[model samples]
Target chain A: SQTIHQWPATLVQPVGSPLSLECTVEGTSNPNLYWYRQAAGRGLQLLFYSVGIGQISSEVPQNLSASRPQDRQFILSSKKLLLSDSGFYLCAWSVLKGGGYTFGSGTRLTVV
Target chain B: TQLLEQSPQFLSIQEGENLTVYCNSSSVFSSLQWYRQEPGEGPVLLVTVVTGGEVKKLKRLTFQFGDARKDSSLHITAAQPGDTGLYLCAGADTGRRALTFGSGTRLQVQP
Candidate 1:
């Protein structure tokens, strides 16, 4: 069975501080990875997706960027955090060309 | 860009009641999916509707895809407290890799 893991269940950081969130998947190889952010109990906003290693597609141009360093390792980063950057971040993985996805537990970041 | 809109953004109902959530879109989709999310967790894929006019039932939950493949609905019979969560519909746009998510419907079933 495939499982996803996301780090730092919750974080509190000051404005302008650097941020890094990591996600990894096991039991699958070459899976498509995605990063999504959700507002308070609302829909998810696609941030970035990667079809393969070193390939990232950004959906919304904002203060965040994503990178897939390995086949199953994806990282979301920001050089400078904004108040608006604080939200629930979720990482998901799916088989290539498949519609359904498996998501991680998510990380809640609060920009103080 | 394709978009999906959900109705009844928030619903509070008593357990054992029946409720339905709808997801509508003007653009056609290749496939549609329904997801349920709990607080502080990720959305879990509940079902996927592919063929138009397709209906699939999972226990008390029934999902239907419109004949035109432009809309879908989820109906829960005898809703339970365990059914309380955020319901989201996502569509696979034609020729697009990423799924377009609906605004979402928050359902609360009080016991």
Candidate 2:
């Protein structure tokens, strides 16, 4: 069984503060990783996806960037936080070809 | 960019009632998926629908993929309070790796 872990479970950051959110997958190797953001009770917006280490595809160009440092470790970072950057962040992993995804518990970020 | 539209953005019904949520898209999709998300949690994949005009049933939930692979629907029979959550439909566009998610339909079943 594969699982994804994301943290911190909740975050409160001031404007212009640097941000880092980490996600890791266990029981799988070379899995495709994805970062998604969702507004309160809304649909998910794709932020970034990685096919392999050091390879990231960004969907929406905003205040966020993603990096795949290890095969199962993905990081989402921002140099400065914006009020609009606050939301629910989710990390997911899937096989190389399958469309199915297993998501992490998610992080609730509040930028004030 | 492909877009999916879900009808009845918010639905409130009593337990034992039946409801259907529809997801429509103009662009063709290679595969479609439905997910349910609870408050403050990540969405969980409920079912994946492939093959045009395919119908699949999971307990009291029925999912159908349109023949053109451009639309889908989820019907819940005799809904229960445990079924209340946010329902989302996502489609994988042809040649695309990421899925396009619908706006989502929030369902609330009162007991």
Candidate 3:
């Protein structure tokens, strides 16, 4: 079975600080990866998606950026965080042939 | 842009009660999926309806796709407290690799 892992299940960062969240999937290759953020009491908003290594598509314009360094490794980063950047971030993966996607445990980031 | 709109943004009911959540869209979808997310966790896939007017059941949860493929619904029979979570509907386009998700419906089942 495939499993997705996200680092720093919870994070507390100071305003203007750098941010880095990592997501890795095991047991699958060349899977589609996505980054999503959910603010308190709000639905999820897609931030970025990667089809392959070095290929990323941004769904929304925000301070965050995404990178696919390896086939199974995806990273979400920001040079300087803002208070509005605080939210629950999720990493998801889907097979190119499937109709459903699987998500990781998620990272709760709080920018104070 | 294609979008899925869900109704009853928030639902609160007692355990053993029944409820239904609806997802509607003006654009057709190739496939629709239902997911449940608990606090501090990622959304988990519950079911997917592909063909128009298709209905799928998973235990107490039943999912139905509209005949036009532009809407869907999730019905929970005799809900349990464990079912309390955020319910989301996502649609996949015919040629797109990504899905457009609904705003979501937060369901609370009190025991």
Candidate 4:
């Protein structure tokens, strides 16, 4: 009965503005969490993943960073957003290695 | 890093037609998974093939894993409009915890 919640469903931010997208999981403990970004036409790209709190592994180097403030809460942030940062962001969790992952509803971010 | 190549980047077929999509990789995988994603939503797990040369059927969809553990295929029989979506193939290696996903195949089944 695990579920993930990602918010602000839709966001529009001005260029060089700050950004923060939050994701939290319920009904699971110490699960592997991941962040993915999907751009138009291009497929989903892995941004970051965490095996535990404060243990984030970034896959792609960009103007973004991730933090696990709590066991189930993950935050994606950027000091200054860029036009290229717009995309559909997804959060996912998995209990076992190489196992099926349950994804969140996702957040659509548009950097103007 | 394992790389998966999915062909037929885009596919459009009429309902009741049969089609097959492939996923090939140069590196061996401990497991392979297929997912379906709709617009405005995250991808959902469809099936996972573990054992080499394993074939699993889910209703009208069939999945096959290559004997060398380096490739896989998905076949849909009598496809329906509901089957239209983006199909992605991901492979996992025993040495790596993360999965390497293919670019993806966008499928459209016309009603």
Candidate 5:
């Protein structure tokens, strides 16, 4: 069985601080990884997706950038965080054809 | 860009009542998926309807995909308290890797 692990369940960062959120999948190789953000009382927005290592496609350009450093590891980072960056971050993984996904426990970040 | 719109942004219903959630789109899609997200957790996929006019039943939940593959519906029979959560519908745009998700529907079944 595959399980996804996401770190820092909750965080509070000051404005202009650096941020790093990591997501990793266990028991799956070369899986498609995605990064999503869900604002309070809103839908999940796709921020980045990677089909393979070092192949990240960003959906919305902003202060955030995503990197797939390994086969099952996807990272979302920001050099200087903005107040609007505060939201619940979710990580998801899926295989080639099957559209259904398994999501990791999200990271809730609040920028002050 | 393709967009999915869900109806009934929020619903509060008593247990044992029946309810339906709809997801619609103007553009056709290859497939549509339904997911349930619990508070403080990620969304869990409930079902995926691939073929047009396909209907799949999981216990009390019945999901149907429209013939044109542009819409889908989920009907719950005698809903229970455990059925309370956020319901989301996502569609796979033709030739796109990412699924376009609807705004979502929040369902609360009070016992």
Candidate 6:
């Protein structure tokens, strides 16, 4: 069975600080990865997605960026965080053949 | 861009009651999926409907895809407190690799 792992399940960052969240999937190769953010009392908002290593697509323009450094490793980063950047960030993976997404536990970011 | 709209954005009911959530879209889809997300957790897949007018059952949950392939519904029979969560509907279009998700419906089943 495949499993997804995310680091720093919860984090508190100061405004204007840098941010980096990591996501890794085991038992799957060449899977498409996605980054999503959910604000309090709101639905998910897609931030970025990658089809392969070094290939990334931005769904919405904001303070965050995503990268696929390896076949199973994805990273979401920001040079400087904003107060609006505070939200629950999620990482998901899916096969190329329209498979349903498998999501990681998610990282709750609080930018104060 | 495809858009999915879900009705009854927030629903609260007692356990053992029945309820239904609807997802509607103007664009046709190749497949539709239902997901449930608990507080502080990512959404988990509950069911997927492919063919037009398809219906699938999982214990107390029943999912139905519209005949036009542009809408879907989730019906919970004898709901339990454990069913309290955010319900989301996502659609996969033909030749598309990504899915467009609905805004979501938050269901609160009180014991």
Top candidate (DockQ): 1
Q: What TM-score, computed on C-alpha atoms, does each candidate reach?
A: 0.98, 0.98, 0.97, 0.97, 0.98, 0.96
Per-residue lDDT tens digits for candidate 6, residues A4-61, read 9998899999999999999999998899998988887556777888999999999888
Q: Is the docking of candidate 6 incorrect, acceptable, medium or high quality?
A: medium
Q: Can you give the lDDT of residue B31 in candidate 5?
A: 92
- lDDT digits (tens) for residues B10-68 of candidate 3: 99999999999999999999899999999889999999899999999999999999999
How big is the positional error of residue A44 in model 5, measured in Å on the Cα after superposition?
1.0
Off by over 4 Å in 2: none
DockQ of candidate 2, scored on C-alphas against the true complex (2 decimals): 0.71
Q: What is the C-alpha lDDT profile of model 1 across A1-112, one tens digit per residue?
A: 8999998899999999999999999999999999999999999998999999999999999989999989999999999999999999999999955479889999999998
Looking at candidate 2, what is the lDDT of residue A6?
96
* Ranking 1 against 3 by lDDT, winner: 1
Reproduced native contacts, each prediction: 0.67, 0.61, 0.51, 0.55, 0.55, 0.49
B1-111: candidate 4 lDDT, tens digit per residue = 567889889999999999999999999999999999998888999999999999999999999999999999999999999999989998888786677778899999999
C-alpha lDDT (0 to 100) for residue A67 of candidate 1: 91
- For model 5 the local lDDT of residue B67 reads 100
**Model 2: lDDT to the true structure:** 0.93
Tell the DockQ for candidate 5.
0.69
For model 2, residues B11-76, the per-residue Cα lDDT tens digits are: 999999999999999999988999999997888999999899999999999999999999999999
Model 1 misplaced stretches (Cα beyond 4 Å): none
Model 3, residue A37: displacement in angstroms? 0.7
Model 5, B97: alpha-carbon shift in Å?
Answer: 1.0
Comparing 5 and 6 on TM-score, the stronger one = 5
**Compared with the true structure, what per-residue lDDT tens digits does model 4 show for residues A1-112?**
8889999799999999999999999999999999999886446788999999999999999999999989999999999999999999999889988888888888999999
Model 5 spans with C-alpha error above 4 angstroms: none
Candidate 6 ranges with C-alpha deviation above 4 Å: none
**Model 4 DockQ vs. reference:** 0.70
Residues A1-112 of candidate 2: C-alpha lDDT, one tens digit per residue: 8888999999999999999999999998899999999998888999999999999999998989999999999999999999999999999988944488888989999999
